[model samples]
Each structure stands twice: as structure tokens, then as C-alpha cells.
Target: MTFTYTVSPKDWLGIAPIVVLVVMALVLMLVDLVLPHAGERSKHTGPANFTVLPAVGLLGVLGAMAAAVTLFFVDHPTSVFNNMLGADAGTLYADLIILAAGGLGILLSPAYLKRLKLVHQGEYYALLLLSMTGMLLMAGALSFLIVFVGLEMFSLALYILCSFIDKRQTSQESGMKYFLLSSFASAFLLYGIALIYAATGHTSFVDVQKFVVAQAHGHAPILLLVGLGLLTVGFAFKVSAVPFQAWTPDVYQGAPAPVTAFMSIGTKVAALLAFMRVFGFALSSVQSSWMPVVWAIAVLTVILGNLMALGQSNVKRLLAYSSIAHGGYLLIGVVVSGAAQQNHIGASAVLFYLTCYLFMNIGAFGVVSLLERIDNTGSDLSDLRGLWYRRPLLAGLLAFFLLSLAGFPPMAGFAAKYYLFYAALVGGHPELLIIGVVASVLGIYYYLRFIATMFMEGREGSHASSTHAAFERIPATPRPTRAPTGSLTRAASSTRGATAVAEKPASTKIAASPLPATAEIEPTHELEGWSWVALGIAALGTLVTGVILPFWLPQLQQAAQSLLK
Candidate 1:
């Protein structure tokens, strides 16, 4: 017997965003093959000459976003490909967020890659789009098999992106660690899926849900409970929830800033949405079996994530922990959504908060990316000291993002949390609300400390006569040739020479006290044009999302209704 599979136009329409991204990635990869390397270009050409690949990538992301918006407007929730994937408001909303993150990441990469002499432009942009496709797939997946496919697709791409900085041992190490740990998580998730399939004789979420309801009315199997536990562990690891979060700080610190920013928001949005779908729908009848476990994880993640972040001096690591804490807050929505009565409130809160987080988190990391120097330097607290005096605009924008992350009033973060906690209270989960509130309060200290360090702290040694004393220590690079013997050049020469000589052996020590009065070190890295654009877009997004909450909230509510439907 011969079998034929019938495909419909609606199925293709359901996946238009993914199709667009994949095509763009392929085109970009091919185009990159023909593009000349930077070294082949004239020395006088600026980095803009190498921006074509990123530009194409940005266009692709924008195109995908447009497609997602169109799909949202269509407002049809359909499972395509034999119920393997869905096209619905929830998936489209996630697509918009993922595409935005991908765009911002692309915008941030050109300058960073150029500064660090990393020139695999084709691979970078292609992998970014490909990763985004995986996230989109995860957001739309309707079955366990599709989820696994999407998970591995993005995970593989991320492993490569994390290791893109070949010169940095830390980057390589991060890649290896993430790969090993994430593979283990994937295995657990897969085994859980397998166990669930064996228990229910189905991998489709709808069939699993039916089986779960039947089992709930009869006798539920212990194997199903075990599968649920394993699934929770897998998702917890992906979302960086407490005990599984040890890799977060190291990976975020070691990866390039743009990659960290993209991963922070993209992975959370994808994993959390999948988590919600799996538990809120497929396993809703058995929630009582897993509710307490999830509750404990959420509580621990919030408390420990905040406390650990307090002592961090590195901006990236601090944000990494902050992300964990945010995951805890999002978990409140997950718990509330699992209850059949409060699903809409919980789901809407999650979508809205993720929207808010996408902007504020990416904006904060954009500032960090702009300031980061070659070899992943310049993210330390000391680098941010007196930042307001140097780059007032950037400092203010960063402060806004930090305040938003801290859930300060009149910002998106505060609005998002208010809805989230209120939903918890309405859902009869007062403990989660209380814990989230207390954690937000404790989290305030670190965010404010960073702001204070930027605006209130003095330069390292401002009272000293030597410029070198006032500025933060510079990284070691080859010394410039001797300048003219004029007073101005004398100070500049002495500054460079001092830095160079300091790196020499003790036997080659130079006199430290005779430097000219004017000797001052300047910040080595300047914000490039693309970085400025990325920052401006991110800041605008944060401001608009916070300030215009009333206008868009209804749309989010509608999307949430569609999600429940």
C-alpha cells in the first residue's frame, strides 16, 4: 500500500515567519561566501563596509516580525502538520518578541565583531537567524517531538555563538559547559517525553491532555508523575531556576554581550511559554502532583538569585542572576495558569512581562555591550564608576533600564510585576505574591547600587594630579611610537609608556613618580554608530512599553484569551 500526506496552504501560512527566517539565513550564508574579508579591504575603510551581512539579517528579522504581526491580526489558532505545531496569538506574540531580540542582537554585533577582529559575518548572522527560527518553532510546537527538534536546533546554534570569540578561553569554556549541561537537560526532557508517550500512548499534547483527564478521574500512574517531574527539571534548567542556575553567571559573563542579551530574553520566552503550554494544557489535571515542587523552585530561585547578585561586581554576571530572579517572577504566572480558573490572568501576565523584559533587559545589556572593550573587558563596576560624567546620555538610559528591572514605578518592569503579583493574589496564591514582592524589594539594592556607582561615585583617583590615577586601569596593548617632545604629547606618551612598562618584568621597571601633570587615560572603546542605533531602539522600546501600557494591554488580553481557547 502507498500512503500520501496531504498538506494545506494554511499549514504554510501558519509557519510563514519561520519560512522567511530560514530563507534569509540561507541567502545570507551564500552572500557571505562572496563578500571580501576586512583584511582584503583598504585600511582606510570603516567597519560600515562590513555591515552588509548584519543589515540583511536585520531585514530578515523585521520581515519575520511583520509576518508574525499579520498572523496575530488574522487571529486564527490552528494546529498544522498533523497537530505537530500551532499558529496562534500566543505563538505569534512570542515570535514578535524573539524577532525583536534577534534584531537587537544583530544591531549590537557589527561593532563588537569589528572591535574584537572576529570576521565570520556570514556564519554569525546565519546562526542568529537559524537560532531565532528554532525559538519560533518552540513557541509554536504542538507536540513533544517538535519541542525536542526546536530545542536542539537553538541549543546547537547557541553553543556555536557562545564560542564565537575564539581568542577568549572563557568563551570556549562557556560553550563547552553549556553544551554538556544543556545536552544532559535535553536528554532528561526527551526521556520524560518518552515516558509520557508510553504512559498515554501519544506524544501530541491534546491526546496527552485527554489521557491525563481520564487518569485523574480514575487512577493516575506513578510513571506519569515521574515523567512530569523529569519534565519540570528540564524546563527549570532551561529557565535557570535556582539549583539549575549555576551555569548562568559563567555563561553570561563569558559569552559576547550581544549573545548574552539575546539568550537572556529569547531562551526565557521560549522555554517558559513551552513550560506553560505543557503543564497548563497537557498536564493540567495532574498539577496537584507537581504544584508544590514548582512552588518551592520559584521561591528558592527568587531568594537565592537576588542574594547572590548583591555581591557581584561584574555587570554581566549581575544581570545573569537578575535573569534568574525574573524567572522566579515569571514562575508565578506559570503556577497561576496551571489552575483552570485563572488561566487567562496568568497567561496574559506572562506575555506582558516578557514584552517588558525584552526591552529593559536588552536595553541594559546594550549599554554594557557599548562599553565593553576588546577581549571582553570593561564590564566591571569600576568601569561604570563616574560613567554619568563621561557619557550622560548612556548613563541615564542605563539607569532607566536598571530602574525598570528593579520594578520601579512608571516603568514597564513595575507594571509587569504588578499584573503578575495581582494575578497570583487573584488566583489564591498569596504566598507567591508575597515572596515575589519581598524579592523585588531586596533586588532593588543592587540595581540602585549600580546606578549610584554610575552617577555618584568619583573617578578612581580623581584627587591625584596624574590623569592615569583618575582613570580606571587600561588593558595592556602594544605601546604607540614616541610622540613629539611637546607638553601635551609628553603626557600622552608617558601614559602609554607607563602602561607598557608596567607589563614589563621587574628588572625593566620605569620610574613611577615623574609623569607630567596632564597625563590622563581616555576610554579606549567608543560607541559605534550601530551600537548607538541599537541603544536608541532598545531605550525607545522600554519607554514605550512602560508608558503606553494601557493601549497595548487589551491586545495582550485578547491574545491571552486566544491562548486559553
Candidate 2:
């Protein structure tokens, strides 16, 4: 009936990433109020043109990363706030990834927010920082109480972000669904934690491990198994595993594109890290008991997630299913690491895969953002038709990202999957390996469909223009569409300049105004430089990081080993 607790300086070091993030978030939130607009930036100014919120956020995340590097030298694991959280290398690494995701989310947000005419940029960035802080806490929490707190903190921020576009009923529905389902999952997780505590007389992983070791003489306790199963289901929902993944497709499709991108990569990574921590470290002794259950879940996740994804018409929903399938792939690594006791390899592969997943997911969604600009609707597959002619660079990036998701060669996703499959092989799990391979093969269809719809196929007449009541209420009638033009040589070049102008009234059509030919040529030179830069960074990261795997893998391997220790 008693919980013994200890606090130490080492515990602070374990949560160093979070502490730095909190400080940064506060600073950014405050500074955003006074920051000047982007148009106000002068090239010869005394300060850089970076907005206050993004600048502070990036620096804070970098600081968190630096602290994580420092955490590597600290040896002992310590719990603080009466065993609320534990600080160790494993958690520090997870925090590092969480921080990186936050930084990227900030970078991708502003331009999109501006395009959509969303207000309260400061509040948005502040909430993002807070969410990152919560993820850092989730990665490090040692006890169930801390875990619940961390999960709520992250979940609340995300729910609000999802519904930020208040005018869109789909966005509101997405947030409400996530809020209700997530609350239900959290309650189960908490109840499971309580049950485990009742059976073992402890909530901390260390104490639970000791208690379980003490109870080794008896048959496996039913309460303990039930509790563990409940907890696993809770995590399965968070990571979008099969059966529990019902919310994913709707939520991803309805939410804003950037938020979907953030959730796809960031939320899954943090939850998986927590999942790995509990299953690989806390419950390692119960491997024989939980292994079969998780293995079945993994198989189902792979089969169902990929197979169902093939039928989706919406791009976001398709990627949602794709993420679930990828979760199954990562679960294979988790199973290998836990069952075979090669925790380091599994952990390393998970981290590497998560990093790779982020880049490609962001690239894919960035292309979605481009298409969404034209239609302002969800990213249906038809929206991507003729994308190659409209935006060649974005189309190519989307294809590359899709190929990566399909685990094609020379891409980071391929390398990440290879490491995972290798881990499964080394761990002697042939069944999981087979499931992974088969699922990946099935995944190729949807991924290729995306590419083909965007590039290879003819420009099909998609949705007719819908009425925009806020603007002129044009009747919902189909426009006379033209055949696909292979090149943008003549008519496209003439209309290119007017297309870049945002917020023009729908009634305004590009008529051939009597202008000098030389004047018509000038606007073509004024490119949308910022969008190109964003695309370039995303594409470059995807290509550069995977190509240098040899250099990065050693460092990741070292970090992974630290968690095992």
C-alpha cells in the first residue's frame, strides 16, 4: 500500500531534453507576440528575417538535441519526482527524435497557415512546443501516473490542432473522434496500470520487474497478462495498428495536411518508443507469455493495413493505412528485439526507420499541400492527376516518397525496412519476416497507383467545380475540360504568372489582355521561391540521409546499445 520514491540530479539529466523544450516553448510563445511580419523583413537589416516563433523554436529544439548528446555520457538511470519519470539513454534518444519532429512541424506550418489565412500563429507554435515537451516526457516516464499525464498533454494539443480549421466540419469531426477514442484508450491504459500495480505492489518498472521476478515460482498470473494486454491495446491505438486503427483514415483525411503529416510521423514515433520501452525493457521477463499475442497482432496489422489501403481513393487515408502497415513492419523489429533479446538492433532499426519515415511522409504531404491549394478539398487520388504537368518537381517528389514507402531500393524507406527485416531474420522469426515481405509486396500496388495517377495516366476529368458561397456562388457545373498537354510550352506559359497570385476572386478569369509580349515574359521569372525552397529541403533530406546510411548507422548503433545497457 506504500510507494517509495526517490529524487536525484541524475533524473534531471534524464529529462534534460524536456526541460530545454519547455523553456524554448515559453520563449517562443512570448516572442511571437512582437515579431514582425515576413513582408517587413529587409535584406540589409541588422537581424535575420526568420520569424520569432520559428527561430526560437528551432534554437530550442537544437538545444534539446545538444542536451541529449550530453546525456550519453551520464551512466546511471535515476527516477525523479517520486518515481514519476526515469532518465536514461533510451528515453534521451526518443526525446531527440520527438524534438526533431517538432522543429520540422514548425518549419512546415507557417507558410501553410498563411496560405489558409489562419490567425493566431503564435498560439499555434506555442501549442506545438508544448506537445513536443509532452512527447519528451512520454519517452522518459517510468511510472503509469507520469505516462498518463504525458499522454494527455500530447493528445490535448493534437486534438486542438486538428480542429483548428473550425469552419470545416470534417476537421471538427476528426478532432472529436480522436478525442473520444483516445480518452477511452487512455482510461483502459490507466486501469491496466492500476491492475498491474494491485497485482505487483508497484507502479514503477523497476519495482514491477522485481515483483515479477519474485513471483516466478507461480504460474503466470491472469491479472498481469490481462493488464499487459490492455496496455498493449492502448498503445496499439496510438500507433494505428490493425483493428484499433479505425480512427486513422478519417482523422488523417479530415485534418489539415501539415497536422496529418505531423501526426503520421511524430505521434507514431513517440508511441512506438514508449511501446518499445515498456515491452522491451519493463516486460522483457514475460517474453514467453506476451510474444505470441504480439506476433499475432503484428501479422494482422501487416495484412489488414496494407490490403485495405489498396482500396482507398483519398491520398491521406491511403497514407494512413500505409502508416499502419509500416507500424506492422516496425512491430516486426520490436518482436525480434524483444523475443530474441537483441534489444539494441531492434531499437536501432526502429529509430532509423522513424527518422526515414518523417522525411518521406513530409514530402508526400507537401505535395498534398500543393494540390490542396488548387482544390481546397481533401487529397483525393484524382486531385493528383496531371500533377506532373502542373508541378513536375512536386510530382516527382511524391513519386519518390511513394516508392520509399513501398520499400523500393535506393530510398531511405528501403534501407529502413531492410534493417527491420534483417533484425527479424537474425532473431529467427521467419513467420514475421514472411508477413513483412508479403505485406510490402501488396503495398507496392497502392504506392504505384499514386504515382501512376499523378504522372503516367492521362489527365482525367475529375470533380466539377463546387459552389463557393463565401465567394461568388457559382453553380456546380462541369467546365469544358481539355486533353492533356505533354509540355507547358505555349498556353501554360501564358497563364503561369496569374496562377501564382493567391486570394483572387473565383469570377476572375485570365483573359488575353492587350499587353506587350515583353511584359508578359517578365512575371514568369518571379518564381514562388519559398515553396521551392521547402520542397528542395524535404527532397534533399530524403535523398541525402539515406545515401549516407553507412556514416549514420554506426552512431545510431551506438545509441541503440546504450538503451540495452
- lDDT of each residue in 1-565, candidate 2, tens digit only: 7866566677677677888888888887767655555554232111222355556777888898898888777675655666667666666666766776676666666556544545566667778888887777777777777777888898999999888766567878999999999999998888888888878888887777777767844344888888888898888898888779999988887777767777787788777877876777677777788888888888999999999998988888888899899888888877876766644678878877887887877778767765554224536776566678766877888898889788887877888887788778877887777778888998999999989988876444322222122222221221323424532233345532332211322333332322222222222112234334555666777776677774677667665776733
Give the range of the ten consecutive residues with the poorest summed lDDT in model 2.
466-475
After TM-score superposition, the amount by which residue 325's alpha carbon in candidate 1 deviates from its true location, in angstroms, is 0.1
By lDDT, the best candidate is: 1
lDDT of each: 0.81, 0.71
Off by over 4 Å in 2: 1-10, 34-50, 73-84, 217-219, 374-378, 461-534, 550-559
Compute the lDDT of residue 53 as modeled in candidate 1.
82
Model 1 / residue 346 / CA error / Å: 0.8
Which regions of candidate 1 are displaced past 4 Å?
A: 1-4, 37-49, 75-77, 340-343, 463-527, 551-555
